[model samples]
Target: MKKMIFVLVYAITTLTIFSFGKAAENEQLSIALSGQYARKMTDASKKLEELDTAVKKTLLFNESDGSSKAREDIWRLSSDIKNSVSSLPLDQSFSTSWMNYLGRLGNYAKEADRVTDHNEYLRVMGQASKNLRAMADEWEVATTGMVSGKLAISDWTNRLDATKSGHDWSGMGTTVKQYTESDFPLTASESDSMKKKELRNMPDSEVTREEAVERFKKLFPSVSNEIIGVETSKSGSPYPFYHIRFAENQSIGYIDILEKGGHVLSFLSERPFGKEVLPFEDIQKKAEKFLADAEYKDLVYEEARENNTAWHMVYVRVEPRYGAKVFSDTIHLKVAKDIGSIVGLDASEYIRKENTHPQPITKKDWKKFFHANVQVVKEELAYVENERLEQRLVHYLTVTIDEHGVIGTYAVIIDTETSEVIKTERLQ
Candidate 1:
């Protein structure tokens, strides 16, 4: 009996260790894969910009003196864009239409190039340009929204298929206009179209594609290359922005500039980080300068995490009187380790601001509601969204629960005005 008992205890201990080891490894893998996906998304957006620029250059460069070289650029760019899209992390089925459209565009480019008469070429490209621009707008809405919002891959792919136009790169047959012109035109799903229709009505701001490109140039003077093209946010977004990308030499980047007062929503770039390492404070200061230059006002640094490769800095907006941190209004910057050049930024949530609320008339001692074994760790004033998605002032508390032998950590939120328990979330 004693031998059997010993064997059971040993087996249990070994299994627990093995299981936890696997769990930890899985967690590390998940994080690594997530980062990889983000990097791929950044690259894909860069390709899109290149393709957009090539198409536009073809149409316009020929305007004044009719340069054939500009038209010739599209064949190569179209092929490159198709390859880039194919290389994305998504299943091939999800991106098949993208390739289909490029094939058509490539053919169109060749056809445009072969035409001998300048007027004939102009007339042909004029019609093609409108279709190309509209579809380009469609793609912008898809790819640019990812870099902002820290959007999930599943959510991104789901939206990609929504309200999409059908064959021959037709803008309609669905959303943009009448589909009567498209060969074998088909309808966009009704449900998807309505969702997009709803998003189209959401009030943000608007800028022409030209204006968006100019903003990109003014904001990042270091990048002398032509602006790829402007992409719009997904149709499902409440607040949309124009996404613009650029590449120069070994460097590639993209910026999300909002139409709402033309704010810089976010930007990400992949390039050789400088070899020189600066102090953490200096790196943070460099990030701060970038934010200021982007016209992001009323922000204060909150915290930071540093690794060998980069420093991830966070900033949040604080309410003046109560000094409650508005957690939703956040700005994040990832600066290459000590290089001080910002490699990533996500301030999409900060673009839309909510009016500050006045102090609540009622205040309560929230501690009385907890069990006797519950020990209050820390509490603070904060602005957090309640169940209804309405922003509310609350006393956000960190508390520990000791029930018999087991211990647990939790975040408890209490509404200041009504003293109602807003929500409870387990930390561990």
Candidate 2:
């Protein structure tokens, strides 16, 4: 009887030990998976940021000065990013939202090469980027917590398929308030005409295709020998240019230069910008110098905005005669805040309208056009396009006016040609 009892006791003990060991092994496996999931989510978030940058490039360059290959690449990258998202462990809601967003993004990107007045696509892309950034932050926090033993891996995994009840889906910005799939800003066919619109900007000087390629080589010596293609710009394009491409060491680069002056309209390389080490002023100076060397000395810095790890500066042509800002003759330069490198340049507008001259309107002359009851507070020269799509020189006036019982500040644009009030926009 004593031997039988000992055998029973030993069997029970062994079984308990085996079960505990199995549970521990499963826990470790779950933790490893959670880490991998977080990493992929971070990667997807990064791809989305790249997509946002491509969209901004489209906005800045478009058909007027952008390359067809660049537009095509945007489509390709979005597709690749969508595939990346699919590899993530998402539930019905998350997967459905992302898929829908990527599908619409790919469709919009197909015909977004042209310049147009409508910018609904860009606005929507900005919202999507914001949501992706938030998701990445949340994942990072969860991963850090789990690895440090502050969180349970099992708990994190559960949320992959099921979000907590009462969470707002609209905050994700990819779905409607009710989480329906049909609430995208742009319909499939709405931007079709915009995609087909053609914009042309004539360059200040004309150069041969050979000369354009040589100019690009000088700008990027490291890849000069790797030139593979130099295609001509299509008809309806404002300036004649050579679309040059270089492929080396598994990386590719692209540049568009005028066939006349050999001026570069745009440039892009596949290399990543490194860490941010320099201040904004230092980076801005570098960009300014780049524009100066490129023969854009007459342009004045208007504003600088940052996105996708780069600072993009918008420069406007200063009217040589009137001291007015020719906003229509613009240029865009992108400085990689990381490593303080000038990574992009778009001078299509400056090339097209650099010689534009605006008539002068003195301070006293502007008063003759002001409304009788309006009080002028500030004034500046501005080049604006009218409703008729005609570029005009105007005085951008800030004024105070009483509208119905409310005092408001307004911005009024007066056409310098006819001294007529063209438009008034509320400032406050």
Candidate 3:
């Protein structure tokens, strides 16, 4: 009788524990299904709807006619869409497809930022917008039903599977190719091609590390005097540079200087700013003074915009003889809004087009070279750079034409003497 009682007690204890464990699991799952996770799903669906609408608007506006602000908005919306898609709770099969699509969309938006063509932008945006709208509609239906207790998460799972089966996502690969082709250090083949095709021989910078250190000191007079460290490396590029670390306001600051020329390529500071004290005009003056001190003279600011933290600017070299803008010789810089100090300088593009002297005819010849296809509205003399870093003297004509009831603006680059079309790019 004692052995039978012990066996019965063990059985009862095991059953009780098992039943409690099952109940706790059910409760936790109930919380997950109804609370934060469910709300996140709904939010994600709404963001998708916003993205679809944004893309539709972008499709309607030709890139050539859209303002810079419009392009910025589109870029921001594309980023939001990518983030929303990433937050979705999809299984492996669907997640992979959706991520690939989002990757393409992000890349398309990035490329569109740099002189996007009208027909190309329209084509890409149309397809992507249509697909996204369809996905958003489906997501809304599933999310609404799930929240109302009419649909299960598993039902959404089946819909995702169906979506994946319907779309052929194999052609949509990652954006690795676009990254490789953009402005970056050249590969072996690319370098060889560039060397073979270059109009002028590329010069090498041979400045010593000590000279670079002094240059950095001169560039940032406000920084602490003591240098923490100095190192040099090829940086996997054709050029070598010195990476210098210094102290600024008890914070670690750094700068990269080209080894050949002792030019400050970039700089960074960990110090945070409290408020903006100097106006934009003052900031521009400071930047001009700094550039003048560094011997980068006669620069024309091609573009300037202010963000939350700094003034982003693009300065181009001007041809002194002809008084024309040499757009190929460009430098990018940023002025911190709070301190009105130079925070960044990128002269890589200028360095790439070394010794590019374009010999062009008089400005009056511009009208003679204008093609019959495009009605030239405005013409200016500017040095244009091609893909292989080759510079051409061209009559840059900003022209407008009607394309299937849509008006489009384009920059037509006509060769100086030959009157042949060098290239054409859309102007946003």
Candidate 4:
């Protein structure tokens, strides 16, 4: 009886020890996985930053050297992201979805690198950037449990499909939005007919294609090569235009000339003078010069694109010098890059006259007009217009309050020329 009792006691003690050891081992494994995940994320973020810097340099300089550097940077970043994602443990709950998103991003970067045409490259890159930003946002939400990680993967793939589908390459504006949304991908006969219509409606002063080319050559002696292309509207509208791409060695530029009666509506080039190619800094300077006399405050440069027609969409605060204050009376200037001239400025938002001056008494004003704890995080300016020709320059200011509260945003617009308060609205 004593021997049996001793054996039973020993067995119980050994089993207890084995259970504790197994639990400790499992906890260590979990900790290691978390650390690995964090490292991979950090590496991915660093690579992304590098890729962005390279892209900005290429767009701003438009130099062969910059382009080459950007290409290499993109390739390296893609490879690193891919490898980092692959290194993640297969048992990770989010691993499969994250891997899919990274793969799609890699495909976009690869496609962008293959594009030799400057305009095409810009268009592709723009689309890719949008997709990347979306993916990043989705990832954040998924990790925070605001959205499902699996859903994020599906959404990214859908966006990729939307971007990769090719439509008509020719027509006005090499922008993907313009082409994909239009009745582009038209038949050859349809394209020819559209050309005929353009020629018929053109004014007599318009020069022929050959004549325009001759004039352009005289103006830009360095133009070693030229390619002609046509642009069609997405809705099959009668608005179609011809484009000319100029090249000097590895440097390239573009000019958009209306085909209607062959008039040169706009001449643009992405290439900058001297050693610089596409100098965004210079572009910003030009924009600033153009807005010097305007009464607007908080002037901002945003949404610049270098496509067949290098264009910059600038958003500035419109503080009216006199009259009622409107917050977001924005001005949209379409600048011609070839000549560095403003081709069009749309300020239709100011046409709808509104007096935004605070009334003597308002119910909301009495309840603390401003939140003291809120801190501004981000602000964006844009142009908004109504049918009554009333244009409002809009300023969107986002703020973060206490950790428990949602972010708040304020939208304000002002007059275009005379900076005056037009209106202010808040959102949370």
The lDDT leader among the candidates is 1
Q: After the best TM-score superposition of candidate 2, give how far the Cα of residue 356 lies from its true spot, in angstroms.
A: 4.4
Per-residue error at 319 for model 1, in Å? 3.0
Q: Residue 91's C-alpha lDDT in candidate 3?
A: 48
| Model 3 Cα lDDT, one tens digit per residue, 241-281 | 78888876654678888776676667777667658467988
- The lDDT per prediction is 0.67, 0.66, 0.66, 0.48
- lDDT per residue as tens, model 1, 1-428: 99999999999999999999999988677556656666666665666566667666666654534645655666676677677677765434435655666655665566564446767656655665566666566655555545563655555556545554222223322332331234213223333333332333435557776777777777666763656766898887665778787787666889887765566677888787666778987988898898888777778887898877788899988878788888778889988884677778887677655555776746555567787778879888988776444578888888998767788899989888877688899985
Clashing pairs in 1: 140-231, 141-232, 173-179
Off by over 4 Å in 2: 1-206, 220-225, 234-239, 247-251, 354-378, 398-411, 424-428
* Residue 17's lDDT in candidate 1: 100
- Model 4, position 30, has a per-residue lDDT of 55
Candidate 2, pairs of clashing residues = 200-238, 201-238, 205-260, 205-261, 206-260, 206-261, 207-259, 207-260
Tell me how candidate 4 scores on lDDT.
Answer: 0.48
lDDT of 2 by residue, 139-209 (tens): 34433544445545566556544557233333443432222243245433333212222223332457887
Better of 2 and 4 by lDDT: 2
- Model 2: how far residue 4 lies from native, Å: 50
TM-score of each: 0.46, 0.45, 0.49, 0.31
Arrange candidates by lDDT, descending: 1, 3, 2, 4
Worst 10 residues of 4 by lDDT: 165-174
True-structure lDDT of candidate 3: 0.66
